[model samples]
Target: MNDIRLYAIGEVARRTGLSVSAIRFYSDEGIVAPADVTAAGHRLYDVHAIARLEFVGTLRELDAGLDDIRRLLEGRVTLSDLATAHLSRLDDQARRIRSRRAVLRTIARQHTEAEQVILMHKLAGMSDDERDRLFDDFWNEISEGLEVSPEFLGLMRNGRLVLPDEPATEQLEAWIELANLLQDAGFRREVKEALHETFSSPGAAIMTSTEMVGVFERGGAILVRAQEAQRSGAPADSPLGREIAGLYSAHMGEITEIPDSPEYRAKLAADVLGIEQMYLESLEEAATSTDPYTRYQSLVAIIDGTAREAAEFMPFAWLSSALKAVASLKDS
Candidate 1:
């Protein structure tokens, strides 16, 4: 009868592979009760105790604390409820892991403990309202004195600061930088005032925020030639030069003019070169600044319209998202 398999605490630990102290801990916590006690008060157990210990180990690995484990062992909480909470926690941990990975990618090297702390705090702390407030401050500063439409005001109102989910290192770094920029009140106010000034100042960029009833055309002959070269494998110099020249041509079409003439081509070349000057200035402002609104406005002015443009500029994904928000609120 003794060799057949009822085991003592030491035997249970040996077979289940739990340490003696851990088994004792579980017993004390009421997670794994003794199957029986000896006449001398030693904990004697049968094989059923081994099964209970196995269940205890499974719950602990899932981060189920002792109280929850005991509740489960006593049949107080359903397995379904436990599983749901455990999975949710795992998903949250995965998101944090991804954010950390992004910080690592941005640094392009290993991070110090201090960097980890700062990066995590910035990337993880803000709620959506907080992020929106940062953008609000920027637009108010930039649109100062400008005759922006209510529609345009709405655009600024609806701008959302998008932080990446499963962030890459670059995204995490960008997020940290963005958060720090938003913290300064004076900087945001300055951004709004500057934006108001830009919209008031210029030949373009402020063309009704959607300058239309104006022509919409692509760059002419030069652009065509450049596009052809892309197919012909010509030196990128000639080809890219043509494409760059096309930008002004496209604007000309939008403005109801076509710059197909050689003289116009020369002017277009000058204009493109002019764009470089703005780019340089924008680079300087962004690098030396602490205001998100200002950085975004500069980015909008310097960058071209493309996929990359949406990320840096005002949230140009359009009224659709905001419109959706309004619709949702109205219906609710």
Candidate 2:
């Protein structure tokens, strides 16, 4: 005990690389107390206190709150516990930074109005529950008063936008866009009108609304392949393009219980291409058209971490062109 070395505040600062004032602050906060007081009323820290100060400085640099450090030093929480807790906080901070960056980038790119900028920022900061409710409202509004079965309604509601805890910039942007799109009255009206036509028109008798929606969801894989083929720059009349067109032809035929024929293929192409169409006949059209609905599906794909499968209009446009070519060739 007699040989034990004690360090004055200045010496402790030199050894721990902490400012003298910081050391005094820690001491006052009871994070690292002085070992003894000199007769002249000077505070002195022992080697153990110096080590504690060093650790305290490290934690502070890591952005740990003083209360957390106090808990750690007081043995209320283990070092591993402190690290785990701080890691969670760091992750939260990172997510916030990413969200802010996304908002700023969107504003710069769009030259967004002040009101819209506020809305986008608020959308980025929405809680999980708020986001869920937003999605629910979208589905509910679209399906309201429709004769669709409960199962079909449930399917509509099931396509939720779940942003990961650590979302990328693109994902955050997609979420904001999706939120805005869902809130758009024009978008909602279009979707509701399409759903109404699907269920109330003569086509509803051929296949239940539930079955039709199922076909759309199930045909996603085929559309994915068509998109891939289109991206390879294959002309609409090329073999690969024709093959994809045939796949869609068969899928649509199966859905409608009508065999594939030149006449039917021609009509399918026309309906999906929005030519002489009373309502949306294909999910391809709904999700790959020039309308806001297409943007909605693209954003959904991004938020779902399936951006690679997100379909743009060109692919489906190429597809419709191929369908038309096949029909014309068959008739010739």
Q: Using lDDT as the measure, which candidate wins?
A: 2
lDDT of 2 at 147: 80
Q: Could you give candidate 2's per-residue lDDT for residues 47-70 as a string of tens digits?
A: 888888888899899889999999
What TM-score should be assigned to candidate 2?
Answer: 0.65
After superposing candidate 1 on the true structure, give the runs of residues whose Cα lies further than 4 Å from its correct spot: 1-4, 90-124, 152-158, 164-172, 202-206, 209-294, 297-332
lDDT of 1: 0.56
- Model 1 clash pairs? 102-168, 102-169, 106-169, 141-192, 141-193, 142-191, 142-192, 142-193, 142-195, 142-196
Worst window of 10 by summed lDDT in candidate 1 = 314-323
Number of the top TM-score candidate: 2
